[model samples]
Target: MSTIYKSEAGASEIQRRYREALRAWPVPAEHIHVPTRQGETFVIASGPEQAPPVLLLHGSGANATMWRNDVTTWSRHFRVYAVDLIGEPGLSAPSRPPLDSDAYALWLDDVLEALAITSAPIVGISLGGWMALDYATRRPDRVTRLALMCPGGVGRTKSAWLFKAVLLRLFGRRGIRRSARSVAGLEKLQDQSVLDDLVLTFTQFKPRPAQLPRFSGDALRRLTLPMQVTVGDRDALFDSADTAQRIRQCVPHATVRLLPGVGHSIFDQTDSILAFLRA
Candidate 1:
């Protein structure tokens, strides 16, 4: 059942109906106030508790709902936990002690610990992916398997668009709605409604993490855990093959896949993600 007991859709809407919208949705979620330091709350949603645990993290400027379209399908086989990154929009709170990239990784680790997710499969996309890799490098024992989708921090990313976001955020949160509209209406974004819904709910974003630092390439090599990496062929970030190679050099045992015509957003490559995780 969704922690969100009430909905604008209708209070009388059967639990199943809301679940239908939220259950197999692109951005299906509810408002949960999970406790953190200083009585703060963090919002998160998931597929089911009975399945194998898989925590889903979104990229910067995105939220857990980005996985809504993919979660139900993936959750059928693995328990999927989509988190509203604390210090971000959605139901999370106490967006304080502003951080850098490594700090972001520690914050994630702290959230999982608070959630009691001691050890589990973690799949991160973009910044989330970078966090996952950084976490694994820092404490490989805590993660069983790792999956990174067009993760950031591999090298200089070609995100001239992100600069627009920086400028708009400085202007104020109101600009985000317009930004969200622009993001949702893009031709590549087929599920405009899902992205639209996500953009509408981005109440706050964590203060920016610091510029990319030289992360622990040596630490990443020592982990023997299975790894899978993917990026879109047309991704604006890194060119496909080089994207995989750079990550592969960090962990030679990793398997890398490229999606033709796909971009940086792994949520866009829903089917392939489900297939790889299920395998």
Candidate 2:
């Protein structure tokens, strides 16, 4: 299988930083590696063993540590499993699976089976959100509740905006920071260290070029599990208003929120997400 990093040295450096970030996780957690056909999936488990489970999936180019700020609060109420998606710049396998197929769904099934989780609530951001939705659609009985943060595949993504993002990538660090700020609609990033790490990963890692596969209206309509969808009004990737509207129209029982003055990044909604999960 092809690797995602440009070079072995670059991959090592990124892995080193990933380890450093994991070490600095605010809450105590256990790192476990589970074998699967995709590869060895890495998971950070925390909270009580007897507590209800909450599965977390991070966006593209990020590992489980992407939930660093939110994990502490979530661990207080439920057992949290922050999974590093396979083929990303985490401790997981470097096997890149085709996004258009049911590969991700199958891979997730293996991970969940390895963990012995029959059913659980899932929270995901961006690309991770797409994965959660894909899995839920494929195996509805396995997912109890679903929360998506600025998730892709629900609405149309503008090609012009994607071109602009590609242009921003050419100018290096300042361009990256500017692009991030533009996406979040925030003057300052919530975590600069995380941003710095992302920049490094971008330079060193070879992320998949394929855009997330859009879910059809019929697919959304088929979701029977309780669902919550939140997106920033200013999201540069997808049309946020359209996203919320589609969720409401297709998934009639879904709770949808469009945050004003926000952008593609919706990490700040951790508390509301916790409330939604508990409710």
Candidate 3:
């Protein structure tokens, strides 16, 4: 499979840091590899074997370890599977599937099948949220509940801002840090190690140069599963108001929350998210 890193050395360094982060995960977990039509999928499984299943998906430029803060609590009540999305900076295969195709849904199906999970609740962040939404639209039967945090695809992305951010990144570390803050609307990152890893990935890794495909109103309407959506009012990518408005308009039964003063990162709302999952 094709790799996403710019060089073999860069890929190795990022993998090393990722492994270090995984070692610090609060809960005991098992790493598993499942073969899929697209590629090999990596997953971090935790919690009791008999507990109800909950699938967790991380955002772009991230891996399963992004759930470190939430996993400890979440694993207590449910069997948690944090999946490393294919083609990203994770242990998963480096196969970049077409965003406009059903490849992601199919890959997810393979993951569930390998784990022997018929149906379960799914929680996703940013691009991962978009992936979960895409899968739910294609196979609603496999998703019992869906929760999205600052998900893409619900509203149009601001291409001009993204372009500016990319240009800023080319200047150097300061420029990259500025771009990161602009995209996330955060003055300071909660975790320094996560920020360091993200910086390395952005500077050294070769990311897929593709934007998320917007979901049509008809597609959103077909998502009948119980759903909860949350976005930051200050999100720099998509218009938060438009995102919530679209979900409310298309999915009438869906619940939406707009966090004030928040940005792209939604890790702080773990308590409420856990409550939603339990409910």
Among all candidates shown, the one with the greatest lDDT: 3
Error of 2 at 226 (Å): 1.1
What does each candidate score in C-alpha RMSD?
7.0, 1.8, 1.4
Which candidate achieves the best TM-score against the true structure?
3
Mark the regions of model 3 whose C-alpha exceeds 4 Å error after superposition: none
Candidate 3, 149: how far from true, in Å?
0.3
Query: What is the C-alpha lDDT profile of model 3 across 1-279, one tens digit per residue?
Result: 236888888888989998988898898999999999988999999999999999999988888988998999999999999999999999999988899999999899999999999999999999999999999999999999998999999976866667878899788898987777677665566766667777787777776689899999999999888899999887888888999999999999999999998888775778888998988
Candidate 2, 1-279: lDDT as tens digits: 236988888888888988988889998899999999987999999988889999999988788988988988999999999999988999998887898999999999999999999999999988899999999999999999999998888888756665665788788789876665564444557667767776777677886788889999899999999899999898887888989989999999999998987877775777988999999
In the range 1-279, model 1's lDDT, one tens digit per residue, is: 222222433223332232444445553444455555423545455556666778777776555656666765776777677766654434454353433445655676666776668887788887678677777777777888887787766645666656665566565656775555443333356655555444444432233545534345676567688888887776654556766767678778888887776766554556766666667
Number of backbone-clashing residue pairs for each candidate, in the order shown: 2, 0, 0
Q: Using alpha carbons, what is the TM-score of model 2?
A: 0.94
Candidate 2, RMSD to the unseen true structure: 1.8
lDDT of 1 at 224: 81
Global fold similarity of model 1 (TM-score) = 0.71
Locate the minimum summed-lDDT window of 10 residues in model 1.
1-10
User: Candidate 2 — which residues are off by over 4 angstroms?
Assistant: 169-172, 183-186
lDDT of each: 0.61, 0.86, 0.89
Off by over 4 Å in 1: 1-32, 37-43, 94-102, 159-186, 194-209, 237-241
